[model samples]
Target: MSSLALHVADKRPEDPADLTGFYAGLLAVLNDAALNHHGWTGSVVADLGEIGGYVYMKIRPGEGDEPFATIEDLRAFRKRQAEEARRTEEASKQARLI
Candidate 1:
């Protein structure tokens, strides 16, 4: 298994939305490959901010040398992580209010 890290910067786009869309498109391509292939095993982490972004991915074979997960799976994991962070922040806010 090999690990890959990609850093992307878009200075041409003054609008943050444009930069974000560009990043999202790149992620879609990676996720699409995961969805279409069976023997593809990897997860991608996208760190997007106002300045730029980075994508960290790992490729590995699954047990029995099968595909590990799909793009949807990665997306679900990201969603869950984000939700957990949000919940934690909310809890902290509530605690501070008390």
Candidate 2:
């Protein structure tokens, strides 16, 4: 089944360097993970404030068919009809030559 995991962390940044460091550390952790495969994708959203900040990281997994938008939904629907049409045209050309 498809699932979505969102990690929301409320933070107060003392300086710009602190926010930069926080993002860097998160990226490092993501890069260190070796088993991130099979439709695993992540994104980070940061809310900035003068005295503080908050960041939310969301990870989504692709699977199944449901009411929501899955990764597979976009990938499967994208260009599939065009590809099929191209293949059909090629087949028709080959039939004409034969």
Candidate 3:
């Protein structure tokens, strides 16, 4: 099966102990969304803050072809993210107004 991987990185050297738990939280969210059914494999790591470590999810396509997000999917995702950001900003503004 072809595989695709995602990476999350931070440049700060905070607490390494928090990395695994952070990634586990992410995994829980992803798994809750049935991401595993999408052929995703995930992992997390932390090394000296230089690497910043990351949580990686791999997607495998059928027939051993690499999995890729279509342009439509990318666009949809971007739109959703933007919407969420806007909602968050609006909420923050309302909270500040209170």
Candidate 4:
């Protein structure tokens, strides 16, 4: 896919950690939408380029393969995943013990 750059102008974060946190949080949103089949999507595209190199986000609420999501969506997906993980873990333990 062709990449596009974003120009944030004066809204850039000074601390590098801020960028890292943003990227991670955004990733979580996208991952949740992708794995949960929830009615949403989250996306972020970033590039380091002169003039326009920047980060962009697209939040969609539909059954589409777009990287875009909301905080509430991510939380719900994580909770469901955690519950499923526990169930799987318990099942494995039971099988091993049998």
C-alpha local distance difference test of each model: 0.52, 0.43, 0.43, 0.48
At residue 14, candidate 2 shows an lDDT of 59
Candidate 2: Cα lDDT at 40: 40
Clashing pairs in 4: 6-54, 41-68, 41-69, 42-67, 42-68, 42-69, 43-67, 43-68
On lDDT, the leading prediction is 1
Backbone clashes in model 1, listed as residue pairs = none
TM-score (C-alpha) between model 4 and the true structure: 0.38
> TM-scores of all models?
0.40, 0.31, 0.36, 0.38
Candidate 4 per-residue C-alpha lDDT over 13-88 given as tens digits, one digit per residue, 9 for 90 to 100:
5687786566456556554654465433433333221234444443333344654544545455556767888999
| List of clashing residue pairs for candidate 3 | none
Model 2, span 1-98: residue lDDT tens: 42344333446465876765665454444323312432344332212122245644333332343223333433344357468779999999999999
Top-TM-score structure, candidate number? 1
Off by over 4 Å in 3: 1-4, 8-68
Q: Candidate 1: misplaced stretches above 4 Å?
A: 1-51, 58-66
Mark the regions of model 4 whose C-alpha exceeds 4 Å error after superposition.
1-61, 64-68
Q: Rank the candidates by TM-score, best first.
A: 1, 4, 3, 2
Better of 1 and 3 by lDDT: 1
